[model samples]
Target: MDAPFSMYGPDFPFAYDHWLKHPEGLGRIPVNRHGAKVAIIGAGIAGLVCGYELMRMGLRPVFYESGQLGGRLRSASFEGAEHMIAELGGMRFPTSSRSFYHYLDLMNLKTAPFPNPLTPAAGSTVIELEGERFYAKTLSDLPPIFQEVAQAYDSALEEGAHFSSLQAAIQRRDPNAIKAIWNPLVKAWDERTFYDFITTSKAFRHLSFRHREIFGQVGFGTGGWDSDFSNTMLEILRVNVTACDTDQHLVIGGVEQLPKRLWSHEPEDLSYWPNGTSLQKLNQGAPRPGAAKLFRDPEGLYVTDRRGHTDRFDAIVCTCQSWLLTTAIDTQESLFSQPLWMALDRTRYMQSAKTFVMVDRPFWKDRHPETGEDLMSMTLTDRLTRGTYLFDHGPDQPGVMCLSYSWMSDALKVLPLDAEKRTELALSALSKIYPDVDIKSHIRSNPITVSWENDPNFLGAFKGALPGHYRYNHRMYGHFMQQTLSPDHKGVFLAGDDISWTPAWAEGAVQTALNAVWGVMNHFGGQSSLANPGPGDVYPVWGPIDLDELS
Candidate 1:
């Protein structure tokens, strides 16, 4: 599918080569050089990418992961059968991830084209309003209010080159126009709910019932909720990376391979810190003299597991949930007071859930006898329940059907239900969509659910901007390097998805890593090039720098 707008066009200009330069070149404070040892916290996509870039730049980056790698790109297995991968956190990727594609080429991975459900299983959508189910297809199909909003949206999109332009047109109050369009679109985008936009915005007041229909039609038109921009990046990575093998698609096996390949070192030269010993070394290297002095140290960083072990690092790049960092550091006066840290804590995230249900038969294949179409349907329903979506698993598994039930915020509140209870609630909910099926029996026999809340490392799925949060902040996370007082600080730096233009996706992680590498190279006075070089040319084959002398 073509991108909605060209992110690389002149209007949205980006500097690739300039970004490849060192962070110090941008007049940012530089890190102090202690030993060449770099410590990376969190083995998720961001951590892995940063480590890969650091290793390529001749710095030894030791990665510390409290849990398994691929923090959010996690998967689960069924009852002793073929291990079906379920994206407990992030589920899809987008096509605009150019850097991600480049990295994939470097890694050597392949892609399996996702089946388009546009034809065979093309399901209709239904909106539950005032206890009535309304079929929502064309603009005219929705309630009158929604129809007017839909028309306004179509007009806005047609008249203006971009949404922002359309908004400007609305602000101008063209006499020829029938009604305002900006309020609805902006509200929907901000609230993630058309209803909220309509009820709250004064501009929507003049919209006729028919104009309002446009809101529902456009909102649920083509791409449903599960479709993510990150999927394209994944495909690019699959096609490009030589080191990445597709056969091993499991997160533990395949995704984890990225860091292992980057950190591919001889056993003799590597010091494995499975526990928290490495963190201790980072604390010891703190520039300040006392415990309070620890916070004053420029390289002061900390990583903690709920299990009680807390480790510090010289330069820490955390790619975990924004809220986790906020809550964890709330009581610590030192960390929260920092300007960068304070901004990060204020960021809000959207909540979502994914449920995987294994059915006794591929019930979706059966056609509705009356309608003569596939009985299965996928809908973006009111924010009433968790499982708002429905889809089929495809031909690979003939008789098995997998249903994904997702709800944004409301669902997250009651998540992490014990397995048995979760299965019971899921089956109960599935019965609403597939009323005829024996959901209880099917669920009793086979059922599974992935609750992000239960995940200790990742408190939620992905980071989403809350209402009014985006306006206050432009950059999603901190972008530049800071000066460290210690001699070792020069080589130490931070890289994570939470620290780049694109956040909460694999692409962000890749970009963050690239930025970190460029920052390090710039600090060390290395030349930047875009040539495609082999692993040996890109990364130093020699082992890590000696750390014994520095200690």
Candidate 2:
């Protein structure tokens, strides 16, 4: 039988998990180059991962942050509450995300099953659409119409995308088998949108348009997918084939703790660094200020901070959002070729907004007096709130409530609202669905809200590749392979979820950061272990397929 599903490359099918777990460790830099400085722009998860691995390889990684240390992984605690927190960004992680788990396990963090739409973790689910409400303990509890909608999408995936066989290939870790199916699909679907695939598929075409609408509103694993209808079908396919939307778990306490712990974590085995040395020790107590400019001085690559403090490095890895390069930093144009610049400039980001309120307790689980059904459940709605999730912190302890978690248009709708107004808007929409439940009376703390797009440091939540934008993704994802690049562009690399095939997943950030680590090591004349070749060592052989430019 094939091995359990892993986030292996349907695109660049390298086993980053195996490479990281190898006994030989991730190659090495020259002894003379052990203390060479490398600038890591942005202290987000991606930046932290890159810095941690580079430090293990005996390189000193200097971090620069524009905002807080966690970046989008901000987990702000409620006033007066010590343990409860609002996870404002990337929360759900799949079991398939082995590379991310590699570090998460190393940090000794724990995770509980995320309360996705119909998972056991949720206990119960409430789907509200078109002002109608339906509660289900499982998918079988839903009406036949909902069942039909789900079946049609399943049939569509099998008929249109060869879903099962492709997934089996990924599970088996057969790069050749995956590419044979995926490369052809890339050519066939690169210019097609997700909506196009849904409308034109024989299975979906046979079903009513209402089925399609219901499918979008109550999407598989998560909530609504309607916001991503305009994205490339490849993006959606990648998420499905990788199980990125299935069997997800959330980091206990807060996801921020992973990056925070990694910042101070000292690897059991490392090169050159003294015992008990940590990333915290290398950079003194805190990171330098935000990088305001990226330009090359005659001597070396230079990073100028917002306060005009400057540092030179042998190489740099930028983990900030792509938009920041153009809007916030004065990066010399020559550092990137015209096509690459265009690719970065043209990359699209989907807006996402979230609102959270700490409640006195997990009141949502209380059953109605007359009915046996749950008083409230993990909610998915077409209303302004879009999706609502409840966090249970034992039976009596206070719980956190995510009032709204929305993306794209739904997110933009409340982009201008304050936390109080956003909370009011969410409660108003939810009232129509759960008029009997008084969510307002149970509130215990000030609401927390975030519109990532409104933050200059991150122009938007994450990337959303449009139809025909495959080339742009190709350019950005492959930028870390600097062997063929001009000397000017060789030293600088990009690593983030946005620079990955599967954006919005922490695994993407982890994998891309590994690629950047490989890039930095190779820049200093380092090499990978023969037994455990890095992504760069085998990238040329197993890299993503390239489509014709004319097409």
Candidate 3:
């Protein structure tokens, strides 16, 4: 029998070329061969990867950052305790992410197995429905009782496949099998809930509850919190680093070390300026401490520290978040008119909060019943204002238990609490999950909350596509370094997670940077000429164009 809950039916077409041939297929812009100078914005993983790629492709890049690098991969110290490294924004990766693995291997980093304790108790899953608790020893024990429900789900999936095939068949004017399958699948795909869809469809009624459980379990593993795919990717990134040709090396110290090391380069050709300084008063403005700006021209790119001083560079590469670019430039109205800008604006970012609590010892080890297994109990709360996940990150120090609580958008709305309130609420929620555990005496809660909505420089947590948004504007990937205005404007190119195939993740950011590097190579390799180049490209260098365009 076929594996349960497989969305891919035998009839489902697995053609990748369909995306390439679609009307919106990579909308690649012609390159400007004479363009040489380039600027990279953002210093996250995406920016770093792009810079590395550009440098390898025979281009000198001066990277800029409005804040510390590794944008969200930040760590913090509590009460003089050892600095605790936690991903403040993006966390984890999947093994199935091929590109990410390739980049990691290229970087030559090492990996460690993620800390998931092997125990028999880990296999159980709990589900809550209609104020009642349900437990399953294995996926086969799930409680979906209606026979027709399974058939409906299967039929819906089959119909979805039929629709795709039908559309293809219609082009040939073949109407024989169209009406029987196409309409039903379309209606099913529009379903609001899995339960509703499964119960209403045919060919799915005979599915056993065990089959549903297996499907649900696998789906959870693939897409849920402990997703194996994402976890594998993270392992690759954690261990891989690119070999340095010079004395310089790129290894994992702490994520913050990346920006600090880059800043230490102190490139002579580049000048730095403070955020509020004017170009005219480059030498006269008082330096602003801890804040710096970088400007590039023919003489070189300059990075000015808070106190307005300048360092110059022959070229610049920006690997920062795109949202920072939205704020740093003076001509917001004009820049916002670009198709890329509109695409960026339309991207939705989910609001999330993570709370790390350090408690005295593992209380659950002793409080459980004789039959209870050593497992992290995950509770799904009915309360609208509660946190979603509560899991252990293991004990780092004696009597210290690390617990993480994550709140998604819905939780953010109902609780409506600030950082401090959120911490209290999270603690309260944790109490509910472990009722007998003594939370008050040992709880050392240091909550970190990021409101992507409030950050002017980071507008939101990377980028997420809204409904129908991904289908139309998918081709924006190949236009990163396309010439705009004139030939001189060619030096400035966009680089960020928003430009990749998948937005809002580290993988997307890295891929976009790679695409940007290719764009730069194509533009400067002499395929197209523009009337004006940006300020950074006043002095032009000519190069031959042979790189493949990604359209």
The lDDT per prediction is 0.42, 0.91, 0.40
- Pitting candidate 1 against candidate 3, the one with the higher lDDT is 1
Q: Please provide, for model 3 over 1-551, each residue's C-alpha lDDT reduced to its tens digit, 9 standing for 90 to 100.
A: 42111111111111112211233322222232222334455556666665544433334444445665556656544444454344456444433233444455543443332222111223333444334544444434545552233344335544434434644443332333443443333232321334333334455445665445433322232112211121112111111111000011112323444433332232222222223322112213211222256444455445554456455543444454444444554322332236556665555554555555544444444425654643333333333322233233345542222233333444356335666666566556556555555566765645555555556556556554433343213434444545554443344455566655345444455555655655565555522223322212321221111122311
Answer with 2 or 3, whichever has the higher lDDT.
2
Best of the candidates, lDDT: 2
Candidate 1, run of 10 with poorest lDDT? 287-296
Candidate 2 local Cα displacement, residue 412, angstroms: 1.5
lDDT tens string, model 2, 1-551?
Answer: 65557889888999989999899988999999999999999999999999999999999999999898978877889989969989988889999999999989999999999999888999999998888899998999999988887888888889888999999899889998999899989999999999999999888887888888998888878877899999999999999999998999999999999999989998867798997988888989688999999998679899999999988999999999988899999998888888999989998999999999999999988988878889999999999888999999989899999999998889999988889999999999999998899999999999999999999889899999999998888999999898898877789999999999999999999999999999999999999989889999998899988885445
Tens digits of lDDT, candidate 1, 1-551: 53222112111123332243334222212233323555565666666666555443445455555566556656555565443444555443444454554445445644332222221233545454434455533446567766555455444333322335433332332312211332233323432332443433455556665344434322433323322321222121112221121111112223333444434422222223322332223324221210111122454555444344555644444445555554542224444325445556665444556656555445555666776544544444433342334433455552333344454544564574655665566555556655665644543135556666556556655554444433223323323333332343333344555454345556666655665655555555444533432111222222111122333
Q: Name the candidate, 1 or 3, with the larger TM-score value.
A: 1
Which ranges of candidate 3 are over 4 A from the true structure?
1-37, 77-84, 106-131, 135-138, 145-219, 222-324, 332-337, 365-367, 384-408, 414-416, 481-489, 526-551
**Model 1 segments beyond 4 Å from truth?**
1-35, 104-151, 154-161, 164-205, 208-218, 221-314, 323-337, 383-404, 439-446, 467-478, 481-495, 525-527, 530-551
- TM-score per prediction, in order, is 0.63, 0.98, 0.60
